[model samples]
Target: MHIESDQEGYRSCVNNSTSCQAYITYQALQDDTLQPVGLCFRLSVEQLAEALQIAQYLSVALDLFTSMDCELSSVTYIVGLKACRGLASEKESDKGLYLEKGITIHKGVKEHGFKTDIVVATNFLEMYSNCSSMHHAREVFESMFSQDAVAWNTLILGYVENGDYAVAMDLFSIMDCEPNCVTYLAALKACGGLASEPESEKQHHLQKGIGIHKKLQEGGFGSDIVVAITLVDMYGECGSMQNARDVFDRMIQCNAVTWTSLILGYVGNGQCSEAMDLFARMDCE
Candidate 1:
């Protein structure tokens, strides 16, 4: 009875607090004050886990999952892994701690025999990707995969992030599904990365980047503001000011990234006056 009282008191304190309400309790999930938009939510553990993770109450969600007496499902594990990423990114000092915790959660999933489940494996891949744990991400990729683009894109993005640009492009080339915007972006980034290699690679990188640009247009993604901006960056990285300008000219809408990349391309090519002119236009626009 004493322990029950303390638990209730703790729940009450957390429920009333504005910023530090990080505790998890079944009763708390039912409280009127905490119901989202005033709707009663008698959420199951799985649903509450997802809800709490979406709300950025990451620690609270983990607590709820860990405290549950029933058998945990794959959805809960997926949400828990994502929450681990949230905590890892919430602070620079605490990143390593949460990454370690993510690995531990992966261990539990393996013990529960969900390791063979492709959807669970994909979320684990995403968690490892977010933490830039490429080694673990690769392991998850090899353990289970499908012909869908989502898993392939996540792994490709992971390689691009870790600066394994060659591997990134290779993965993109071998992907079974038609490349999507994310896949193209990662591949384009890989092409841009090659410009920093030996001078012998510059022409090759530029040509490959052009191919990607053509593909983007063919896929009707070239006009997208972000993709166009990345195209400008890829051109600048490959030392192709003309191609950069071509992309800029074709842009239906431009943002600071588009303008900045164009200006930087000029500056990189020793055309400081051209850069200044573009900067002036940017400032006005």
Candidate 2:
């Protein structure tokens, strides 16, 4: 009887884990006392999975579920993919197996005629991105029949996170959807990444950064405090103190981040005196 009850509990746990996780998350948000409850649950999952090699069981269950269900929902795939991603990161030897499982699910999604589902595609793209599989992410993105701003932003940020700044810039240029604030911020980060390249590539990236800066202004993001601060930092990192200062001077508001970016830019360029002056002004403010 105990064994049968335990088996029932395992089945229930597998079926209801997602809801349990959601409830735990809500509890944590609503009450500070519940924060440790969520953390403990997450930590226990990892520890239990490690002890019992649960990834193997999960893979088998996923295969069975997919085979039995004529049409798998996007949410199901997303949850499965997330689990694969977590397992992939846990051990080098397990990475290939989990990645292959994710790829299988991707193929299944297409074969089962859910390819046009944007949420599913985005979740698939994000799963690949999180797993450091940019090539797969790009493939999923490019295959989308219609892309949204969020989808475009996801791929753009994915490239930036993967250190493929050049591709991120190219993707940004061809994006059919209107770029959002997150898009602009990710592009700025790509420019910053470019500035860190070798001397031979430095000027080329600086020019690209300047073009993005112009776009930011035209898009009316010039006054956004975060955007303005990013511009200062980008120009400073590229050794363009004059342009950085030009942006700083135009800002209607200057926060601590804005002041710090300029000061660091001056310091980076070996202009300690100018940095000191800016620090004094920042202190006064």
Candidate 3:
């Protein structure tokens, strides 16, 4: 069997292990063992982590550039944040240091005055939120004179994650305008966390949820597989299998999520026979 030129070139590079003058190509292979440009680009970007490691080995600070601009790209800043967070946790002696680094970078950005840049601001909020520094997240949020839905959603999510659902709901309610799909999803999850509810209270939240669902459908988010799956999961957890099933049945294309949610809904609601029937149908599909 004869090898193709690209394969031959790859093999030659691997054998020689020398600096290459030719424009070398690399790719990511999927499970079926085919390669595509889309996959290759994804793989290349993923390799940045490994490249960072190699740069470390060479005693190079990848973030340090001698150029006057000296600006790091957003991706590089995020990667730096990840690296700092990863180390700041494992090295117990470095306690308070990761958050310090995050604060420092954020301060530098502010002193340099990219404070108004939404991308940088969002990254700062994410770093603080992930570091379990809700105070810092709040400061960052409050510093912004104006916020789009993304900023509001992030803070609401942070509050929910930090186990302050009341604050999350309060912030959610007082927002100047209606919540977007992501906001609705987060709010629904928080509402579903209610352990025990009086029948009247349950009806209130359920009605609110139904209203959100209607808004979602009107906003063209109803057909989103992720939103649909989340609705199914939420309704199932809340003992609303009928609602879950309605969502599932409405899906134009059912994937693993739709099938799993249906099975889960029946199992959760103690409808074992229905769960088993769905499983059988899924297997046939």
Candidate 4:
């Protein structure tokens, strides 16, 4: 049926495989059904794991990558890394397991000469980041063959996620490429993270946050709901209740999260009456 050449067949294979349990795929492998279906990326185990990723069967994909899969392609490494990242985000109880598997997959990727491949490398960086292994994540970023905005965002996000706010903002300043939404999001998060610093430090980041807000408005992202909400939150964290209200007023649409951000800004700054008034207004709206 030339499944490899048929686009519809390719899609069907992915859909079917995404629904597959590890045992089902394993049994299918044992039964040689893949030889005929021919659409799971030309019958490759790596492709099967890619399909499993769509269903977020992360552990199942890892099991195949670690054990049953004999042929390890670059895609297999990426799948393994992504699965490791997914697992890291799942259960706090298994933190060691996620980092260990991620490190192992990285070693295999290097051994197989895929360490320089951009996709594989970026996934490795993300896996390390999600595990909060910023030291390893920074090493991966530095070793990448090329650093695009996506890679830059991943590293910055890793620092922000790890509460290294100063380092995150420093990266934002020096990224070689233009920033994207993810970069801006990470930057705002860093600015927000500075709220607990001394007054001078907090005010310094507040100005930077304001600068970023202006850039977002110029870049036509000021009205982006997620960005606007985050901007509001950043201002709130910086004790700039009026700035938070300004961003709130500029948003084209306001969700509950958006409304709550501004209200919390007032409450956090000790403006109890303003918080109550804003909450009442939100209910009316």
Using all chains and alpha carbons, the TM-scores for the candidates as numbered come to 0.81, 0.65, 0.66, 0.87
Residue-wise C-alpha lDDT for candidate 2, range 190-209, written one tens digit per residue: 98888877767767777988
lDDT of 1 by residue, 1-285 (tens): 122335444434434443334334445655645422211121255565665666677887776666655565777788788787777667658767777888988998988999888888888777887787889989888878363688898899888877899988888888888888888998999999878788789999999998988898899897898898888888888888888899899888888877888998889878999999999989998
Q: Model 1: what TM-score? A: 0.81
* Model 3 score (lDDT): 0.64
Q: How accurate is candidate 1 locally (lDDT)?
A: 0.76
lDDT of 3 by residue, 49-128 (tens): 33443334111112221111334444545555555545544455763767787776776676666778776777677667
Report residue 279 deviation for candidate 2 (angstroms): 3.4
lDDT of 4 at 8: 68
lDDT of 4 by residue, 89-155 (tens): 8976786789998998888887889888988878877898889899999999999878999899989
- Point out the worst 10-residue segment of candidate 2 by lDDT: 44-53
| Model 2 lDDT on a 0 to 1 scale | 0.72
Q: Show pairs that collide, candidate 3.
A: none
Tell me the deviation in Å of residue 96 in model 4: 1.7
Candidate 4 local accuracy as lDDT? 0.80
Q: Which stretches of candidate 4 lie over 4 Å from their true place?
A: 1-15, 20-44
Over 4 Å off in model 2, which ranges?
1-72, 79-101, 104-108
Candidates ranked by TM-score: 4, 1, 3, 2
Ranking by lDDT: 4, 1, 2, 3
